[model samples]
Target: MSQVQTSRFNHKKYQSFQQSMPALKMENRQWPSNSITQAPQWCAVDLRDGNQALIEPMSVAQKQKMWNLMVKMGFKHIEVGFPSASQPDFDFVRWLIEENQIPEDVTIQVLTQARDELIERTYQSLAGAERAIVHVYNSTSPVQREKVFGLDKQGIIDIAVRGAKKVQDEAKKYPMTTWTFEYSPESFSSTETDFAIEVCNAVINVWQPSADNKTIINLPATVECAGPNVFADQVETFCKGVNQRENIIISIHTHNDRGCAVAAAEMAILAGADRIEGTLMGNGERTGNMDLITMAMNLYSQGIDPEIDLSIADEVVATVEECTQIKTHPRHPWFGELVYTAFSGSHQDAIKKCLSVQRDDQQWDVAYLPIDPRDLGRDYQSVIRVNSQSGKGGVAYIMETGFGINLPRWMQIELSRAVQEYSVRHSCEVDNETIYKIFQQQFVQANQNFEQQYQVLGYEVHKQGEQESIQASICDGSVHGETQTIHGQGKGVISALSDGLHKTLGIDFQVQHFDQIALSKGTNSQAMAFVQIKINNRKYMGVSEHQDIMTATINSVLAAINAYIDAVQ
Candidate 1:
């Protein structure tokens, strides 16, 4: 036969499908009473649906890596791949059986169309696994029947019955591998509710699923309709109408075409779904599948153990994005960059005060943040940053984290104005480091009074032979314009400078530990140093930055003494 003739025959075969039968409509399309408090067991379809949608599908090695990560994340049942589709998929399934060390408790699932050859191949793929499930599905909606496939209602039913028999017969060969029969009334959301139940009941009978060999009726809101509650009502009605509730596990697969997939799945569980099939971050064909991570995390936040490990969710999202070439939006819930970050002034201030009061992050409300970023292996450095939107709280956070300089209430307000002005002018968000630099340039350096209180003109260090000592010459900027060039010797350059200041200005203070950190990337990155000084049991802080550590050290020490004097009087 010609290729055109072959294409025509295939088209006719699909078009022969019939319309779904309608049943008595309920008085009110409402969800079941029990749906208020329930969460379903999750089965991630990333390796199958997600991989199929990727521009460049993952290699076998990459697929193995993803599977291992998913298993680590406590996924007991993972739809690994569609085995009968291609050579690589077949090889990947065989690889899991031959080489991969799948856990004794975990079950690997494979998908295939409702055909005998594919069903046999699917069974071949499950060689030595302790637990394996065969997912058999065929389109049953009227649109699919009339437009896509020319099948009458009975034609679709015959296809389903034959498919279920083939799957059951093939699965019988593997008596050792516990078999699970799952059927999806493909496009169930759009099909007549009564017809969907009828088809599902037929499969349940053909499979002869006992309570032990439980069959799964995966009722997907394949194309989401109306609100989530409406879909919930449909699931509730269908579950109530199905013949064998004890012998079947009601599973939900919702697509996010209407952005209600997650809500629908949650409602479905309430309406009586025991299992869930979705993709991570909702990656799939159309608008994408429901996001399992979001739903699972939602349950976690509500104090319900969804029985999934989300500790590696950050890594999972990153790996999937690389393979799929789709970036997770920065505003995406739970994992977004700004999800835990707060740019608003009020939120920043509250978080700063909370951090000050309780060193433990768990105790803080962390307004606008649901969970601690550290819990997800993310840093809290970006939580509070500066912009026109920032406030005194943001400035204080910068002082505390970037420079060890703790500003008083009055000082914080004074600096917030300058930082906010700069942020607005630049039209950009600022980091703690930027706020620290601004604070230094204005409060520490711009004021001549502060500079005059104590200023070091120049200093040189010379090591003496007898002892490891250093000598430095320094000048002071006092009100009397007093420039006293004094020479002092001490163990270190900072010590020598402190000694020179004490002698010249009649000021005495003990130099505490000094710290320096690189401010940027490059060979010539500036080293920012903070000097802690204590005089008469009162602590003082000073910060400075320079290309040379020695220069920064000298400036930092003097700044500390100046701050102490200003604080005291």
Candidate 2:
């Protein structure tokens, strides 16, 4: 039987349905030439759009917690909810007003559709808000008009104009409360540029805003269907064509269907947008809104204060994760747990060197790190991690940062090889504790085979004339288990001890290197000694820690001798 053949995917089948968004025809576009030098007005829509998209919408208590967090984070404008859509939303709005949870400086905004009953219900919910923005929107895109609303261009304009007029009239019933009107051509990105301008101007005329009373003209990329540049062009065209530009504040609300919400928002600001509406970490409908945290940090990285206090970023992420039941991705910019950690050998080495230099000028100049982690309350200890890919520099960094053990330059490479071998055998990351244990077992502690081979019983040193004399007691590990005493003279105690060992035990080994450092800064602090020696053409390293400097040096030399003996036997 002949085998069935499979052909390549049929690309022609999808061609008939493909469509391309036309670029806006505009000359002398200024947005391309403009740079974002200052931060735009920020409005958090977390409690409204973000809450609604949750698998289980936030309860009143959860909503209150989120609201309090946002207030503490320095947000002056927060869209609390779409009061006219659901009972919980309406109840939360009413609770804020009744319980006096809203701060006086904060302006709460609520969303509604372009209908009389919804607008009236929305205004009723905002009965006693100190200052509120009554946001009204209608579907104005060509596809939305033809497919969703089944309305013509004039019919769509009537919805926006009628809603603006209703919002203006309903706001009068509560004369004590101040109201600002906001209108959106809901799918402005997909709408015809001229028609969007026409509808927005009609609403602007109906509201008749002035310098004292500003109207917000929000253009939402309800569904991102084009590249970010095209969205910027649409924004620029509306800014140029809209009427009463002086009294109008252009606001942008972009979704992340194409993963370009943040880019679009930034470009919109370049295109003369005055306000940005988004949720924390980009939580919203479908692909979610632009992440306010990411965008704000982007601005902060460029030396601009984003006007929001993100120093408590970890707390913010924790609260959002607990409330939303969604774990933040480990690679989330500026806030993720692993974002500040370095595992690559070259990266860890560079970071280790960069942190060692003391600079009087406080500038974030570290390589592979855009912003200092300390700015977000993270310490430098966790910045470098040791794994199979780590190098000697990283191992040294862990030792110094974690345990205050500054290994010598040659010792670093030696210890790094041992650590890399262990990491490869286990195929996992080595923690600081594990690395410390390895250091102890390899240098400070005697190997199991040579545990009772030789022990430093006691030692005493005295200066005689121009040289030092040492008398030492030692134990020999043999079938007889004999103890011996010997005396020798040399330049120093360590040298005298070496000479004593050769004279008494008949074991000769030359000390190659010797170094010592205080383990801490205090009069009674302990000291650690490192010793390297060559015995029978084989080199070995050892370390010892004790309160007395002389004792630590003797113990280190004995440990190195035992290590070499264990290797040979």
Best by the TM-score measure? 2
The global Cα lDDT (0 to 1) of model 1 is: 0.78
For residues 70-142, what per-residue lDDT tens digits would candidate 1 score against the true structure?
8888888899899988778888888888886688878888889999899888888887888888899999988
Q: Write the per-residue lDDT of candidate 2 for residues 102-123, one digit (tens) a residue.
A: 8888999999998899999999
**Model 2: residue 227 alpha-carbon error in angstroms:** 2.3
lDDT of each: 0.78, 0.88
Tell me the spans in candidate 2 whose CA falls farther than 4 Å from its real position: 1-19, 358-361, 447-449, 457-473, 478-513
Model 1: number of clashes? 15
TM-score per model over all chains: 0.75, 0.91
What C-alpha lDDT does candidate 2 achieve relative to the native structure? 0.88
